[model samples]
Target: MHRRIIAPGALAAASLLLAIPASAASYSPGAPGIGDPYYPYYGNGGYDVSHYDLRLKYQPTTDELRGTATILARTTQDLSSFDLDFLLDVSEVRVNGIRAAFAHSGQHELVVTPRTPLAKGTPLSVVVRYHGVPSAKTAYGFTTWHRTPDGAVAADEPEAAWWWFPSNDHPSDKATYDVSVAVPDGMQAISNGTLQSTSSRLGWTRYNWRQNKPQATYLATLALGRFDITTSTSEGGVPVVNAYSKNLGDNDGAARASVERTGEIVDWLSGYFGPYPFGSAGGYVPDTTTGYALETQTRVYYSPKQFANGSNTSVVVHELAHQWYGDDVSLKGWKDIWLNEGFARYAQWLWSEHEGEGTTQELADYVYASHPADDAFWTVKPGDPGPDNQFDIAVYDRGALAIQALRNEIGDKAFFTILKGWPEKHAYGNASVADFRRYAEQVSGKPLSALFDTWLFHTSKPAAPAARTASLAAASTTVAQPKSWRTIEATNDVHGH
Candidate 1:
């Protein structure tokens, strides 16, 4: 069933106006909850994810992947238990290591309900091993490859995490990960956090990575290939590492430059905003055609395109900022996605400020000039339809402008204080717009309700004539505001226009 039904209130009008019989549309099996679309469930109950050890037996005639995963999660609710949303290419499922029945809800999600009620916090482990050619159309976006120009296609981006593991399937649930990926003997695997160990058995190599800290499901990643490893240290003394293909061009020098610059950006951001909330920070520039980059915990996966010009600071800064906003203090749900992307975008602007590139007003002007004509900037409610819907320019550029407005209202000291205090107060957790608003009000010692309400929830941009005039007046006193004949002739520079 893959159809959406209208409400009862509209049924009468529809029946009266329509002459033809209306066929009942099938309900989408794996659709998310009514209120929270991305993450349907919520609570303090944590999840333990594992059981992804499987051998990949590839067939040249038919592109397919044969694999399995064991997922162990505990919840406080116990009403004969409920189902969790997972994205996978599964052939078989087993609960408590025994074959269990399961059903596919939609194109992306799977629902497996245990036969018996498990106690709250009691470990309930399920192993799902499947064999199929991974698809790029689904929510997980996991792509299985038979062969590529470089070698076997490595799962990359928001899709790769689903290639092997079954998780909460979104950024909401921050869980602990113990992942062991077994790849062909020649291929090396890279994932989040410090490398625990690697052991070669038979013709396969198993690489182990344990992320003890709380991490969102999307940040979890894995890459397989023969990689050339390079190591460095941050100014703040955090270990920086890079994993690029031995087949690609000279990546060590670019990786070193990227690592050094990344560390510098982290340090700069920490000084203004707080410590780097994550344990370590680095990049993994894989030799691939994918143009996008993901800020996956301490390790960011960058495509070869990002390193084409030696070091892409924009990409580096964007991902580095996520270490604080997205990875450290994530949004409570998809509704508040701006909380993650908006903050990161604003952090980029702050970086520009630190570099003495332009003033905040100039940046605001730039964003305002580039603002999309669609009223969707402030009107599109969260939890719309798909993940791509959440990545609109409004959430990134306009969202940053909204934050910049607040920063301008409150001085840099207070604004940065709020930024530092936000993740520090809510470390390893989730937050909403209301939570941020309250914190900003407390830190800035000003009533920011009107400000946030006008920018965030309102449909139109706020009139800033008074505010602009004040800014211009302040700039004239401290710095040069542009000299003009009309302003110079006036006794007082203040002009009413």
Candidate 2:
């Protein structure tokens, strides 16, 4: 996620002044920035990407990856020039099968000028060829595209897809993918969707993966290494593909057990969150130095640290829940990340309550009481947490608390509607906090402006859900009683770290 400056004269070099065909004169250069508040230059404009065909080859000995990205998109406006988020060294570029002039400009922006004016709604094809070592970068204190011991991982919370391929990297521009990676013989490669085919030829093995469902670029990932692979089917008939590195050694057993519980957990979550959103449901464990686990679309990339210390079921549930909250229903911008992390943390509480290990009420109360009245975590609002605090504990912990507060205020039935209906309503699309507020009010039949303001937007920590729920229930006596209840417990353990 490094902001790249356009190399000296890279964009305006005389060599790139190719003539534009005169058939269509109504065209202008598309704007480079997508206008996101936190990440103004994250995605490109004037085009909608529909599909990507990526062919990659990896050489462990050289620590290098060479690849080609073929993007299929449609123009949103008449455009003579467009941009893709691309880093690394690229050799050739083509637009609609014709050689085109392109350059690296403005920190990861690959500006391409086609020789003709592309009409609005016309299908366009862009191809780029690149080669480099994909190494993790520390941008704004977050690591992305981290190289692991055995293989490498391409993952980031909001935006890092630019590191791997030329793309419309922002979350709002979702696209399906067909990714095929070739590695040395005897090793394995895993990616987003079902494994369509695997073949070997002349000491190289290629794993072809297809993720047909619309996916945000960040959710697209690739992991390669010697792995113990497992495949199963959920009771609901969704395929499950789980893998773990042999490097885990003694911890592999715990990782395998977690995989076994994955199918059952997906079914359990389906009971509450409606059908599983993706075609596949599972996770993969990588021997990565990185500390965190990420819900990478169909497969959550579990770090070695997760199973080595302990495999907390709540943590698993937290990431699995993100497949719905974050992956299926994406964020309109980085500012609205609570729509992703908050709902995942809330799912941890929901899972704990259903399993009788702990109650969501207790979890919420525990998190609310962890900080002093003036703690920084409590002071920052989940919806508007500045860029530095985007992934802070406040975003996850306090976000869950705010959502639990909403559940308490709206009662069980309507809250369930918000949970089940939110994902389905915005299935495979991006949504914002204002969008969520309008949706909640529509489903719950309650004027929730004050509630949303206090819990999600206000700077100060609000009253506990218990006090808020009691007041709400007393105010509206016609509301039905919550289907379940649990007395708050005194435990100090936070549900999901």
Candidate 3:
């Protein structure tokens, strides 16, 4: 009888109640990839990692690595399952202190299904126990783990974290790190940030390194070997630690001469790019056959080959400048790599000028004239260079040329203002080429769309400015072609990612 007199409002309420279960079932699996065009599966989706605490032990004899990684993150969406970018074998995985179902989706993706669905905006803790020979592992046709004679070093651009630890694994999702590595006694384990302490026990030694500032996963590094470690302080009390492999042989003196100036170069960089962005500043010269250097956060990774031709502080300047442009303010995607390489290269020109080597204008003119209009170098657009050309020399040289052009277009005042202001605006964050263009426009009060297109996006060489030609002529006549210009050219020949 009461049902016969049911009101329309009560019917609506009953209908709403019936829809609750369906609404509760709205949760879905997070995406497997972060959707970068260059490297589709480079990073994971649905979560943003905040911190990573990795406790690792390595035995060089067996070339085996064992580790436990504790990742602190927050879900960005309702997640029934999520993925982490990892390549090693996983022994166990725990989500929120509970064992979760997991499987390897691909070479780099470790898919995890939590026992309970996770709501968006909730904090998550994941503990993963893993053991593998990172040197033996390969993904996407290469390995970031470089096996050394005494020990191993994990240092590579945009992909090293996947080898040493499970992570979100992209510049867009930066997090602080606490890397504690335990190796055999008499050996050293070097990593990013400040070295907290070292303890010895049971024929094993553990080194604790902490990075307080937000850093891209790729910037987290690990070097385990015999190193001659030196410590100092920079201009602003930033602790400096330089490591040189004891067996660097002929390259030993040169490596030391170059990286030992970490404190001075960092202080010099602070003058142009604002204060040093990290609490620690230094670099490690490891004896690896890979003839490349990487800007691994506060502590850069320098191969012995970097100093094969005398002390190369120009490379040092390039990497340290990355501390401001690439490290402090990272790329939103792999495509914006010019934002990292170009500015770093430009810093080398500034250093050359400061050292009476070569003016920025001279170097820019040399690079512009060296690469003819029909050269293949012009075809690789720096702003959106594909994965293959991501680290190409053009991205660095032309990228710097773009900067010189910007300076010419906007004058020294506006250009320098942008150089100092861009990092401050996007400190400890990720930005895109478009973001830089907009920021430049905002700072200079000029539209930079056409300028960016000509210098960054065009598939041909940008035209030399009339003023640049005149300036180059004057520089040629008045300047004696600074010795640093030749150094810049030589360094660029071997500049590696």
Candidate topping TM-score = 3
TM-score of each: 0.76, 0.89, 0.92
Which ranges in model 3 have alpha carbons more than 4 Å from their true place? 1-24, 464-482, 493-497
C-alpha positional error of residue 392 in candidate 1 after TM-score superposition, expressed in Å: 1.9
Note the Cα lDDT for every prediction shown.
0.58, 0.77, 0.84
Q: What are the per-model numbers of colliding residue pairs? A: 3, 5, 0
| Cα lDDT of model 1 by residue, 388-442, tens digit | 4466556665677678778878988898788788889989888888888889988
Q: Over all chains combined, what TM-score does candidate 1 have? A: 0.76
Better of 1 and 2 by lDDT: 2
Regions of model 2 farther than 4 Å from truth: 1-26, 136-143, 463-497
Better TM-score candidate (1, 3): 3
Give the per-residue lDDT digits (tens) of candidate 3, residues 1-497: 00011112332232222222344486666666677777666677889999999999999998899999999999999877788988899999999999987777656778787888889998999999999999888875678898889999988876788888999887899999999999999999999888889999999999999999999998999999999999999867889999999989999999999999999999898889998889889999888888888889989988888888898889899999999999999999888989999999999999989997778987877777767678999999999888778878899888998899889888899999999999999999999999999989998998888888988999986654642532433222333455777677666644454
Model 2 lDDT per residue over 258-372, tens place: 6668888888888788899889988888777655678889988777666665555666777888888988999998889899888887777787779775677766655665565
